[model samples]
Target: MDIRKLDDRLSVAPQITPAEVTEAAALGFRAIICNRPDGEAPGQPTFEEIERAAKAAGLEARLIPVASGGLPPTQAVAEMARALDELPGPVLAFCRSGTRSTILWALAQAGRRPAAQIVAAAREAGYDIAPLAPLLETAA
Candidate 1:
């Protein structure tokens, strides 16, 4: 897994396999969040499969799938916030390329920080988050 730290509590990674769950547990990630929609790519493990493996490894897991070209739902953002509040840090999330995952992460953090600061942090991490600016404003 090519994991990139977004902050002290959160990290994003490329799609991971069931085999990586144990390693993630070992690394002290208390929870795993899958941001990729199931069946988006052939041969990708279903969210259930990863969730089962994560649970067996003693880590919490959840699916908050995000569709491309659509704005993230309020429930999705709420669930992420619940995860952040309810689960112990640090948490790890994954998607096909990590862009969607990072976008969701930033959105979930919207009202907690300034939009400019969030965009800057995302940019520093090599993600163009300009499209989310308007959404962040509304969310805030």
Candidate 2:
């Protein structure tokens, strides 16, 4: 898993295997947030598999799957925000390439964090967040 830390409490990553969930717990992650919908790819592990692994590792987990290519829906952002508020940190959130997970985090953080700070954080983590500038600005 190519885990990219966005901050002290949250990290975004490309899809992780069930085994990696165990590793994540070992790395001090207290929760897992799955942002990828199952079956988006042919061989990716399902959320249930990850959840089971998380449970076995004594970590909380939640699935707020976002569709592959688009701005996350308002409800999805709301759910993500709730998860961020409630899940024990540090949380590991994953999607196909980590973009969706990052996007959801960015949107959810809007109005709470400055747009520039959010964009800079994602960019520093290797995501090109230029496309989100306008949305991030207005979201605040």
Candidate 3:
């Protein structure tokens, strides 16, 4: 698992397998948030498969599939925020390349934190979320 720690409460990564979900739980993650849509790539594990693994490992899982190469919709952002609010801490969120999940997190944090702080957090996590700074400011 190429997990990039974004903070104490959240981490992001590329596509993860069922085995990785268990590993994440073992590593102290309490939940899994999958942002990748099903069938996005050949051999990509379906959300159901990962969900089953999460369940078996006693971790909660939620799917908020964001289309590849596109920004998450407003509803998707809302859902992500809800998950962050409702789910247990130390959540692992993933999508292809982990960009969608990072973007969702950044957008969800817009009003709660300064745009610069959000961008800096994403930068620390190895994602260039500065492009969304304007959008974040609008909400901030």
Candidate 4:
């Protein structure tokens, strides 16, 4: 897994496999958030499968699948916020390319930090977050 730290509490990774859960736990990630929709790519394990593995590894797991080009639902954002608030750090989230996960994480953190800072952080990490500006504005 190519994990990128978003903050002290959160990180993002490319798609991860079930076997990676143990390593993630070992790395001190207390929770796993899946931002990729199931069946987006052939041969990818379902979110439930990953969640089961994470749980077995003693890490909390949450699935808030985000469709590309779609705004994240309020309920999904709330769920992510709740996970961040409740789960111990560091929390690891993944998607096909990690873009969507980063987007959602940034949006969820909107009110907690300046919007430009968040966008700049994402950009420095190699994620283009221009599309989320509207949502971030609304979030603020």
Clashing pairs counted in every model: 0, 0, 0, 0
Better of 3 and 4 by TM-score: 3
Candidate 4 lDDT by residue in tens digits, 21-97: 88999888999999889999999989989999998999999888888777778887888888889888899999998
Candidates 1 and 2, the one with greater TM-score: 2
The predictions' CA RMSDs to the true structure, in order, are: 1.5, 0.7, 0.6, 1.5
Clashing pairs in 4: none
Using all chains and alpha carbons, the TM-scores for the candidates as numbered come to 0.90, 0.98, 0.98, 0.90
Candidate 3, 26-94: lDDT as tens digits: 999999999999999999999999999999999999999989776789999999999999999899999
Error of 2 at 75 (Å): 0.4
lDDT of 2 by residue, 41-125 (tens): 8999999999999999999999999998878899999999999999999999999999999999999988988999999999999
Q: Give per-residue CA lDDT, model 1, range 1-140, as digits (tens).
A: 78888888988888999999889999989899998899998999999999999999999998889886666787887887888778878999998988888888888888899898888877877788988899888878
The reply for model 1, stretches above 4 Å from the true place, is none
Model 4: lowest-lDDT 10 consecutive positions: 130-139
Q: Rate the local accuracy (lDDT) of all candidates.
A: 0.87, 0.94, 0.94, 0.87
Q: Which ten residues in a row have the lowest lDDT in candidate 3?
A: 65-74
